[model samples]
Structures are given as structure tokens and as C-alpha cells.
Target: MSSLQSVTDDTFDEVVLKSDLPVLVDFWADWCGPCKMLAPVLEQLAAEQEGKLTIVKLNADENQEIARRYDVMGLPTLNLYKNGEVVKQLVGAKPKRLIEKEIAEYL
Candidate 1:
């Protein structure tokens, strides 16, 4: 099973905003090819960074409210949240090393 947790519109605030550790929210859609490409990388990240970072996926199509609230304009948009606020945003598909480098400080 995938290590990544999925967040829905209903549980977004409680699961992500209220999280104790830094939360990496993957805003993606089922039809997005790049999002599919990044899934495995995120799964690896979720497993490797367990307890240090909370990585969750939010389907942009199914959860439009959260996506718009966060101003997600692209697929596979990675938003890092700390203290209930967005700290960093990464758009598009990227390699695991690059993704790790981008969110290294937060972790």
C-alpha cells in the first residue's frame, strides 16, 4: 500500500493545517499525467520522512474548494505548510532528490 495519506476537503483543515509536523500537500488530479509520475516519489518521501514530515495528497478535481483556496494552478503542486500556513510551493513534476532539496529545511 502507498504510504501517502489522502486528505479530502472535509478533513483538510484538521489533518493538514493542524498537523504538528510540517505538512506537504500534493495538489493533484486523476487525469494529470505529471501527478501520476510524482506519486511514487511522494510515496517514497512519505515513507522515508515518516514522523518528521506529513505528506498528503489532495485531489484537485474532487476537492476544488481546497485547491482554489490554496491557488493551485497546476497539477502536482506541492505546498509545504508549517504552523497552518504555506511556507513553500513547488509546481510540476520533479525528481525525488530535487523534491527533497526543496523541502529539506522544513523537514
Candidate 2:
């Protein structure tokens, strides 16, 4: 099935903002092509970085509030949260190496 965990506006704070491990929240929508393309990359990251990081997916269409609060202006935005604040923000579908490089410091 799905490798990535799904989070909503209600669980956003507890599951992501308050998480002990760094959280990567993917802000996306079903209709977005780039979002779909990035899903597999996210799944790979979640599998490879298990204990080091927590990966959560938020459907922008379903959780507009959280998306808006985080200033998610585009599809497939990946926001890394640490200590209840955003530490890194990556947008669009990128290669795994590039994505990892961007988040390397956080990990």
C-alpha cells in the first residue's frame, strides 16, 4: 500500500509540529501531476530514513487550513518541521539526491 503517513489539519500539530523526530510534510493534491510524480520519491525517503525522520502527507484539497498556514503556494511542497517550526522548505518534484542534500543538515 502506501508507505507515507497521511496527516490532516486536526492531527497536523500533534503528529508533525510536536513530533520528536524531524517531520517532512508533503503538501499536495490528487489532481496535481507533479504531486503524483513526487509520491514515490517521498515513499523512498520514508523507507530509507525511517528513524531519522518522519514523513507525512497532507492533501491540500482536504486540509486547506494547514496548507495555507504553512504558505504552501504550489503543489508538491515539502516542508521540514523541527521543534514546531519550519526548518526547510522544498518545492516541486526533485531528484532524491537533491532532496536529500537540502535536508541533510536537518537529519
Candidate 3:
């Protein structure tokens, strides 16, 4: 029933870092309001850009090491990884158009 594909500490490398397409990771927590706000936008992006990009969500609370490794100080931090490295970092909730424009650069 979930709209977005959820990633965890276990699958971080396999799903995000090693992905063939550009990966957009939403690092968030269950209790964060902004994280919840970004959910719909991420889902829409995932649905629209299925072949162009891979969208993954990582729970900050549950995946502490992954969040800390990325230095995710805020909730709803969207990180884009390409070829095993982070190429972009977007913090806070943003509109769909803005996010799509940013992601389009890598595609």
C-alpha cells in the first residue's frame, strides 16, 4: 500500500549506492512532520520517473548509521547518489516541480 519504496540500513548499498539509475534517497523519521509532508511529492516523482530514477526512503530513526554517515542533520533530507557517490543534497520539504527539476539534471 505504500507509495514509495522503503530502504533500510541493510539495503542502503544495494539499492542506493549500487543502483543503475540515479538514486534519490529521502532520509526521514516517523515522528518528523516535514518527512510526512514530503511523502506525496516523492511518490509522484517515483511514479512519473520510473525508468529515469530510483527513489528510496530511509527511516532516520531506524537507520541511525546511514543517517549519521551522510551527516543528515535534518529530517526529510533528500540525497541523490550517482555512481556510488552523493552528487546532491536537498534538505526540507520541497514542491514537486522543484524536486523534479533538480533530479532532471542527472538524467
Q: lDDT for model 3, on a 0 to 1 scale?
A: 0.89
Candidate 3: tens digits of C-alpha lDDT, residues 1-107: 35788898898999899888999999988898888888988888899889989898898999998999999999889999999899999999999999987878897
From the highest TM-score down, the ranking of the candidates is: 2, 1, 3
What's model 2's lDDT at 42? 88
For residue 86, what is the lDDT in candidate 1? 98
Q: Write the per-residue lDDT of candidate 2 for residues 64-100, one digit (tens) a residue.
A: 9999898899988999999999999999998999999
Q: Which ten residues in a row have the lowest lDDT in candidate 3?
A: 1-10
Give the RMSD in angstroms, all C-alphas superposed, for model 2. 0.8
- Cα deviation at 44, candidate 1, in Å, is 0.7
| lDDT values, one for every candidate | 0.93, 0.92, 0.89
Give candidate 1 regions above 4 Å deviation: none
Candidate 2's C-alpha lDDT?
Answer: 0.92
Which pairs of residues collide in candidate 2?
A: none
What lDDT tens digits, residue by residue, belong to model 1 across residues 1-107? 35578999999999999999999999988899999999999998888999999999998999999999999999989999999999999999999999899999987
Q: Which of 1 and 2 is ahead in TM-score?
A: 2
